[model samples]
Target: MITRRGFMKVLGGGLVSAVALGSYAFGIEPLARLRVARYALTPPGWSPGLKLRLVALADVHACEPWMSARRIASICERANDLGGDVTVLLGDYASGMNLVTRYVHSSEWSKALATLRAPLGVHAIMGNHDWWEDRTAQKSGGGDTFGHRALAGVGIQVYGNRAVRLEKSGFPFWLAGLEDQLALLPGRKWKRAWMGGLDDLDGTLAQVTDEAPVILLAHEPDIFPKVPSRVALTLSGHTHGGQVRFAGHSPVVPSRFGDRYAYGHIVEGDRNLIVSGGLGCSIAPIRFGVPPEIVVVDLG
Candidate 1:
């Protein structure tokens, strides 16, 4: 019941809408949009008296024009203003995309992050990109990457399969951090199904001497299934909410479990995991539906 001229008009309109949406996704959302995503929960066995507020920044993928040092400083300032008891950097400080005009160096981004302040302290872990981007670490298959050293140089404690005990208002809890699950790429010399991951979940958890509720920091959420109930919470980044989500569904996720561990707070069998959407892009500078976010978790 439609005329040829009408069909042409409708097709033109659809084309225009597609172009507009693409422009917004490529230029506006990834570059300009910033948000704070908050979650409040009492994990099983969490200390009642110890109210801990944690601000998490993750997958920074620092690059020129999109995520510059000035912008990172601004993000840090916003995080500091939140007054979290502690702040955790969830890794991927290096640019992961080829579309960057200039890659923001690790030193520059780490220095900007140095401004982050919390009464307890700022902690960090390395993401897959942090390891893959560092040629030296990749070649050796097992050493501190530039991202790790840069963060350490800026006075941030970089955790590598380690746990630290801390007390808040006399209430004690342990913080465990695991190394990146995909620390080494599959090169010619190491052609295997597993990518030579450096993560040691059991070893890290074993470091906790007491029964204090532990919060685990991991770069990827793929390790969530193995997390024990002893870990009150597991915080991760890496997936970036598929970097382009829609209607609470990501068409593609970097995680081995696909959308199962893609983004937001996930609870399974008394274990809890929070996969941050993160503050930057990977593979390309484009985002839609999922905006850049700094995650804040309140626990008791």
Candidate 2:
């Protein structure tokens, strides 16, 4: 019943709509929305009278065009305004995941992050990007240690397969942090390892007493299962909420477990997982349904 003219018109309209949608998702939307995803997590064994609020920021791929140093400073100031009791910086400080469009020094970003204020102080863990071999530096035969050292110099405790006990007033809990599991891969290749070189759950949890509530920071959400129930909650970032999501669906989610532990709160047995949608982009600096976020977690 359709003539050639009508069919062409419909097809052209569909293509135009698609282009418009893509432009909004890839460019316009990313610049506009920066969400604050708040959660109240109560893992088993949380103290009855104790409450702790944690502000978590992750995957800050600082670079040009989008994630500039000035933008990083603004994000830090925005986080500080939330007035959390403690702050956790989940890693990926540079924007080298794609083509290395721009190189923002770790120290530059860390100086901005130094402005972050928290009563219990700030804690950080390295993401896979931080451990990645710098192809750009290889041209000059150098290595990358800026992410770790710069954060440390700014008083943000960088934990690699380690745990710390935070005791503020009557509320005391344990916090464990792991190095990027990918860092353990032989030659830092994109290959997988069984129990990997960087992360040591047993080693990190050894310091904590069984009675105390423990919250862990591991960069990748894929390791959510390995976490024991004794540890109350595990916080993670890496998926970026499928970077270019559309119609409430993300086409490209980087995870071995599919979208199982992709984003937001997920409960497994008695343990809990909060995977941040993250701030900034990787591979392509475009975000659709997944807006850059600062996850605020309240624990009681």
* TM-score, per-candidate, Cα-based: 0.98, 0.90
Q: Which runs of model 2 end up more than 4 angstroms from their true locations?
A: 99-101, 134-144, 184-196, 246-249
Clashes of 2: 0
Q: Which candidate is the best by TM-score?
A: 1
Task: Flag regions of model 1 displaced more than 4 Å.
Answer: 189-194
Q: What is the C-alpha RMSD of each candidate to the true structure, in Å?
A: 1.2, 3.4
Report the Cα lDDT for candidate 2. 0.81
Q: What's the true lDDT of residue 37 in model 2?
A: 95
Q: In order, what lDDT does every prediction score?
A: 0.92, 0.81
Tens digit of lDDT per residue, candidate 1, span 101-128? 8999988999999999999999999999
**Residue 242, model 2, lDDT:** 84
